[model samples]
Target: MANTSSAKKMVRKIERRTAVNKARRSRVRTYLRKVEEAIAAGDSTGAQDALKVAQSEMQRAVGHGIFHKNMASRKMSRLSGRIKAIGA
Candidate 1:
């Protein structure tokens, strides 16, 4: 129902942005899941490596506005803590 030209343009922009954001979110989740699986398997080294990758992905999500700064920070903190616990 975008009657105005600007509104129509905005709708298109939003659709594109939504697709990009969804992909980013999915990628981040995949990284996080890998870390979790490694942790669950008791592979400390693997978990640590996966955590590093997940942290980077989460930070990128924040930079891209796909995730809030605090949310990304919180996830990174928790994952790091878990990884440390696995080592200890």
Candidate 2:
């Protein structure tokens, strides 16, 4: 379907980028899930630690353009809020 050489190259580039992005997304979600699990278990200390890691990973994803800046910020905000509520 790609009629030109450039288009074929672009398709290859896109495929590689998609795989990288998918991996990053999965990694970010794994970190988030860890935070959620810690919060759900009511382990404040564990949750705090996990949140720190998750926040870092999320910001990294944003930096890589895997997530929008505001989306990452919002997720971090909500997760932090839940962490705070765990102690209350």
Candidate 3:
């Protein structure tokens, strides 16, 4: 239990932030899934287009402190590599 009013307020604030973060995470995952689906379907052009959108969404998530910069970069790198391999 929160013993102080300040602690209660902090808990409330944390809950709100958690909800927002969850939504952002879900959005980023959705974009990433789109890219994966396009790649799996062997549509390189579509995958590239989806990757463009996913990259922006991912960068935005990183900017919002939802993902670490290096993690985002790594994910983008792997996805781009897959896209390239599909074209090859």
Q: Using TM-score as the measure, which candidate wins?
A: 3
Compute each candidate's TM-score over C-alphas: 0.95, 0.97, 0.97
lDDT of 3 by residue, 1-88 (tens): 8989999999999999999999999999999999999999999999999999999999999999999999999999999999999999
| Displacement of the residue 69 alpha carbon in candidate 1, Å | 1.2
Give the clashing pairs for model 1: none
**CA lDDT of each prediction against the hidden true structure:** 0.92, 0.93, 0.98
Candidate 1 lDDT at 4 equals 98
Least lDDT summed over 10 consecutive residues: which range in candidate 2?
A: 74-83
Better of 2 and 3 by lDDT: 3
How far is 75's C-alpha from truth in model 2 (Å)? 0.9
Evaluation by TM-score, superior candidate among 2 and 3: 3
**Which portions of model 1 show Cα errors greater than 4 Å?**
none
Tell me the TM-score of model 1.
0.95
